[model samples]
Target chain A: MINEGCRLMVVDDELIVCKRLKQILEKAGYDVTVFNNGEDAVKKLELESYDIIVTDLKMEGVDGMKILETAKRKNPDTRVIMITGFAETETAREAFRKGVFDFISKPVEIDTIKQVIIKAQKEISGSKT
Target chain B: MRLRIWHKMIIGMAIPSFIALLGVLLSYGYIDDVQKRHGYEQIADNINDHVLEVRQNENYFFHFKNGRFLDKLHKAILDLKNSVNKISSYTVEEIGKEDFALLQDAIRTYPPLINDLYDNYLEETNVTEKVRAEGRKLESFVAEKNRTSELTSSFILHLRLLEKNYMLFRNEKSFNALNSKLTEMKKLTPHCFECNPYIEAIHNLFETYKKSDALVAEIQLTGDRLEEITRRMAQRERQRIGSFLTKTKLLLAAALVLLSTLGPLFVYKTATYIVAPIIRLAEITKKISEGNMTLRAPLREHDETYFLATSFNTMLDKLQLTYNSLERSIELLNEKQAQLVDSEKRASIGLLVAGVAHELNNPLYNISLTVDAMKDELNELTEEKISEYIEDISSQSKRAHDIIDNLLDFARARKSTEMEKQNIVRIVKESFNLVANQMRINNIKLEQDLPDEPLFIKGNHSKLEQILVSILTNAIQAMKGNGTLRVSLRPDPESNRIVLKISDNGQGIPEEEIRNIFEPFFTTKPVGQGTGLGLSVCRSLVREHNGEIEVESKLGEGTTVTLKFPQYKENA
Candidate 1:
């Protein structure tokens, strides 16, 4: 079972995607907060510390890359994951260069996303130890 | 004489020489007249001296029978004889027979008469007493005869002396007399000799006295005859000189007329041949200055003027070439400017469509999600009364979802990839299926003329489908109410292209607005009903596949949009 107090932040322009991801992650026994856009996620990251961050790459306002940059700066120990609808090699490379834990392309398979989050959680926990 | 320019100049100089020639003729006439008069005077003087010696010989015989005066008279007689001989000698040298005869008679008769008178005086002085009385009587007779001879001799001497003086005066006075009488003669008779003929009569009277008064008068008469002949010859010479002068004047006047007329003629011909062409060239140059390139100077000759004309024509040709190229360049620049404006219009329309699509996305998504949740909730309710409600909810949700999907699809960014061969018929069927419910709701009758066999095209599948869907949707929208929509897909064998013809029997596009149908954001539909990018996107997509899309329509008639896609070739 996943740790109960482990916190995760989900950022996306699509409110449904963010809510769905948060609900799925919560059901997996992780504490989760959902943000409709990257700007809101960055504001929340300033106040509270998180174990992992998952964000969409393309959005209306601030995007996933900005959230990744801000989250890594605020808490270097936090693990970040990037999700995109379009599979572009340049975006994946950029995300890797930013030291994110994983990069994902959507129509996300739920199992693969679950596994990647679990891996990020394990990394965050290990860092805490 | 060769009449060169210098010859003409010399002839011009002869005009003044002609005046000098007249003066020379006048002086020559005067000198000749003076020489004739002087010769007559010399002959008269010699005759007068001979008469004086004869008178002195008679006086000495009358006074002293054997005196020195007698001897002097005889010697004077001898001297007169010698003078007569000398006159004869002068006459013979001059070949004058009249002067020679006169001198020989004077020498023979005068010397004999003087010897007879001297013998009579000597015989009277030597006579005896008885014959003295007889000799005295004879002496008386001889004395009377001697006195008569002396009287005649003295009178003759006076007449000779007068003749000599007259000849001397005639020689000295003839010129002055002629001059003085000229004015009087002009008033009275217009001829000097006629008005004052007495002067010539006095000269003739002296000439006759010179013949009669002295022993040498015969010599003087010869001289008078000579003078008369010389004067007549001088008159002939003067007449000839005057006629010559008149002829010379007439010739000079004729020559002047000829020169005056001919000189200007020569000058005028030369000017026409040489200077006129130069003047014409200058006029053409002036026209060029005024910017008249079309003015072509006539080429009149094959010389420098002709060459100049050719050169000018060449220059005009060059100018026209430059002007034509400049016009072409300007036309190209205008075309480029129009293209830039068209591209900017497309860019702006694309941005606006993207903005509107983005703004609509969120609300549409929210509505779709709400409908989906309601449908899910309705499905769980267990009541027969709610079964119909669930069905209605499901149907409405599905409708809303479809609308949202259509909007998103229309707003999606179209990035074309490389082309591939695909079945054109299947792509069209799929596109129709995507909008089938909408077509049914509009009650539009759709007609299809699809080929029996599979028709393949070299094109991007998604883009081709999108193009077909957009055209079909536009055709449906144009019909609005119930109308027929016809689609014909056929292969153009000659061009090797597949032609997709979509025509609608509805309100037709206006002629003025038909050209703008493919322009982005140019639409007649109400806002939110048409995005205006449908036809523009179709055209772009067709172009990407190395194909063309065109439309033909008329007001109140229908529009037909034809898409021609290059046929697929497996080998290619």
Candidate 2:
């Protein structure tokens, strides 16, 4: 079971994709915060702690990779997942090596993402216990 | 006309005048010779009569002296002496002589005999009276005889002197007269000897007068006869020459007439033949200068002028051919200009359509994503009452996405990229995937007769795929939602080309409009539902790979579009 109050950040330059992801995650009983750019997401993350961060790989200023590096250094317990429309394998491999938790291809089915979020919550709770 | 007449008249008059002059000259020569000969004959007769008288005088003087009538004899001898002297003086003056012997004999004997007769008359006075009477009678007879002898002697002496003077005068006069006659004859015939014979005869007479008066008279008669014969011959020659001159003049007149009259006629005919044709050729050349190339003149003679006509005709033929070729080229240029204008209009329209489609795509994509999220949210609602709403939203969102995707695909103006070897079959399959649902919606039975083997072509993959999709979509749409569509792909063995054919069993395009279907903005569909650029774009794409597209359609039957792409040969 996942805590409904755990905060998660969703960042994407496209307003529609960002809004959709926030709505879906809110329906699934999690507190979600949405930002239209990587810079805004990074500013919010510096002010408060988020349990998990899901971000678009391509964004204006302060990309997902840079946010991941800064968030991990500021708070080592925070988990980050990279999301992109382009499914380039080399970039996925590089993200994995850089300590990103997971990579997701866009036009992603809602059920698959829900399963991935549940599994990631279990792992976070187990680590805390 | 007057000049010609003048020429003829002058020729005629000159010829007659020349003949008459020649005749007159010949007659004048004959008359002069005859007159000279007659004068010579008269002089000769006079000399002969004088010689006979001198002979009679000598005979009478000798007879009276023999009869012893001394006084009567003296008177007779004096008379005879006077006659001899007259003859001698005539001979000496009329005829040139070294000596007049007849006159000398009469002078020497008669003067001595007359003196002797006078002495005898004084001594014989007392002789017998009877005898004296008889002697007186005899003396009277003797006196008559002696007077005749003296008269004869004086006549002979006068005749000798006259003959000498006459001979000298005749010699000088005849020489001068013969020279004058010879000069006149020379004008006619150059040589005349009628007076020459007379001169020679006179010289012979003078020589003979020294020997005997009778011999002188004989020589003069011979000379006179020769002169008469020469005169007759000269007259005959002059008459013959006059006739010959008249004949020559007539012949010359005839020759003049022939030359003058015939010369102009020959000249006129020659000028007509030569100069007339040349003038006509010059007129034809003027016509040609005025651009009347059809003008031609007849060639009369095979000469340089005729050769010029042939060359001119050949040049005209070349000029006409060149002008005709120029006209044809101008016509071709006009046709090319018309085609260029038509192409430019189509290109402008294509650019406008592409711009409108591009503008609509991005916003339509955002709306589709928002609808998808709403559908998902509806599905997760716990109330079964909203299940229908969820299904409706999902289906509508899918439809909206499909419409936007189709619009985007149509609007995308993709420039052809670099060529690479690509599997043509894979491209075709991808194009089919894009149009499969439309095929289902149309209930069109789609059949693809594509080769299983990987067929490779050198072209841009995206452009080839677009070409396939456009043609297939057209075929399916032509079925009008319920017909059969067949796409056939095959390799042309002879040309090493790949051929693609799409056919539909629905209503066909009109035969008249089939040719225009590949033209941009030419469409049979309702406005806004169809952009006519589909077939046109397909054609352009195929052509980019050096390919060609063609359509065959018949009214109420079917339509088929065939695309042929040349196979890429590495060596080529």
Candidates, DockQ: 0.03, 0.07
Docking class of 1: incorrect
CA deviation > 4 Å runs, candidate 1: A1-44, A47-64, A72-89, A96-129, B1-265, B278-572
Regions of model 2 farther than 4 Å from truth:
A1-3, B1-372, B379-572
What would the DockQ be for model 2? 0.07
Looking only at chain A, give the TM-score of model 1 against the true structure: 0.92
Compose the digit string of candidate 2's lDDT tens values, residues B1-572: 12232344455455545554555555556555545444433444443444444334334432342334444444544554454355445435433232235334433544453344333323223222323343244334434565543223343333334434553454555444544533443353233232233334434443433233343344334334433433443354455455555555555555555445644554454555455656788888788889887777665655555666678777777887897898899899657643443343243334333423332332333344455556667655656535543554465466556645754564355444789887887788766656654553344677889999987788987677667766776777677755778888898989999988889887888878877887877889888656667777677667778999998887767788888887767855
Error of 2 at A42 (Å): 2.5
**Best candidate, lDDT-wise?**
1
User: What does the lDDT read for residue B15 in candidate 1?
Assistant: 48
TM-score of 2: 0.29
